[model samples]
Target: MRLWAASVAICMAQAAHACETALLLTIDVSNSIDVAEYRLQVDGLADALLDAEITDVIVQGQSALAVVQWSGVDRQELSIPWTQLRSRTDVQTFAAQARAMPRAFVLSDTAPAEALDFALRQFADAPACDRRVIDVSGDGTPNSGSDPRPMVRAAERAGVTVNGIAIESMGLAITNFYRREIITRDGFVITARQHRDYPRAIREKLLRELSRILG
Candidate 1:
């Protein structure tokens, strides 16, 4: 009986290390986003992860999460290293780290394509998962770097899904831009009417995306 109990514990520990999905949350820190707006983005994500529903899914699914801050063509930083959430405590710890994450780039151009490319490359170091997704949130369209369409195609070929959250102020122009150029065929884009709306939108987006993985 003792031997059987020990074997079961080892199996459970190994299973806990297997990630069901890998999620890379990328934030845009371009010149268009002021310091206050940057705070909203990071804080919003930190809060979103702590949501009951989001936390449940993350813990249950053993999801791997990472954060990337992106700006110009050559400016991108992995603000948070990949961390797998095996329990609610793990999720809470990651949320705290996210809230305290320092700004990676500022006064730089918006380069979604380069950002996407950079994000895709990081998966090489992440724990192997059945599904991979990149969640990109930005206030404006790309102004520098190569066209994003090709990069979107590259993501598709690599079996990675690219989703977007458009933080728009006056119109749906950014939303439309994201749909047309950023998200993959199997992915989606959520619109935050304004920077202040990011928390709600990000929560909604995470629920949808993670639920899909769970389903």
Candidate 2:
């Protein structure tokens, strides 16, 4: 009797998670970013949602989203717990929380691979998500962790699309590495070519990934 009850509970849990479209937003803040630029990225969180094209896709009670911040091999933090984006109110609240977030992890090195690993681990026990993806934004190549390519494959094997947003800084080499390394369905990287253009980059990038996914 107890085994049957447990099976029913598992099935219901799976049903709930099946309705989730979990997106992990990974923000880069390692040696590449200064204080001002960090604020720019954080401030743009609201724009990612309230922007016209983005709002067109937010079906109430359908999408569940979360955020993960990564810098060094050991530096990874969860900015917002997973929540259902059911209304405009939810987006506003998430933006406020992210903007007001105090840095919980230190910036030591750029471990893009570790970021990918952390994101995968976060989904381990969660309900099964339909469109589970990791959006990794960065300015340069991996300097201090496992190679990102292998982790990219791991993500693909797990059915998580790994999309990228490469910052086109004056000194970096990974201009559009996302295009070369990531290969999930509809997975592509957008380049801003300048940190000053982060807002436009974030808005355009999110619209491409998070909008009309159902249509």
Candidate 3:
């Protein structure tokens, strides 16, 4: 009877923790991003995850989150591992860890292709969720490594969505580049006029994505 009771408890726990969405957030740490800009990006993401609405959705939806820092080829690091947000404390703890994460790469080129490829491979280790989304935020087009178009196609083929946040300083050049080559057909892009606008842009992006998960 005890063994049967343990089996039932394990099944109940698994049902309670089923993952709804696996979200992988990628940050650019190439040479273009100055120290201040990097801080703004990381802190902004931390704050966005802590927003009441975003936090509620993440916890309620049983979302699993991870963060990857990427720059030049072979310079992507999973700064935060996949964490299941089962409660407000879980979300808050993850946000705090995000804010405290150190830079993974510096003085490197912008290699979106490598970054996207790296982000895609990470999903293999993430929790099994109904939706797999990669949120990649960058300021410039790829200047090093292979083309990113292939990785975008790969994401689409794998049924994973690759959204982009373009930090544009010169008009819509970066935004247009992302639209043309980065995100998948089911993915979208949000444009931040400059590094200072990162906080607002990331908050809006998170809300949009999490709300869609709720729907």
Candidate 3 structure lDDT: 0.92
What would the per-residue lDDT of candidate 3 be over residues 30-132, giving only the tens digit for each residue?
9999999999999999999999989998987899999999999989999999998999999999999999999998999999999999999999899998799
Model 1, position 189, has a per-residue lDDT of 88
Clashing pairs in 2: none
Which lDDT value does model 3 have at 25?
98
Name the TM-score of candidate 1.
0.93
* Tens-digit lDDT string for candidate 1 (1-215): 99999999999998877788899999999999999998999899999999998999988889999999999999999989999899999999999999999898778999999999999999999999878999999999888998999999999999999888999999899999999999999989899989999999999999988887421
Rank by lDDT (best first): 3, 1, 2
**Candidate 1 backbone collisions, by pair:** none
Give each model a TM-score: 0.93, 0.83, 0.93
Model 1 score (lDDT)? 0.92
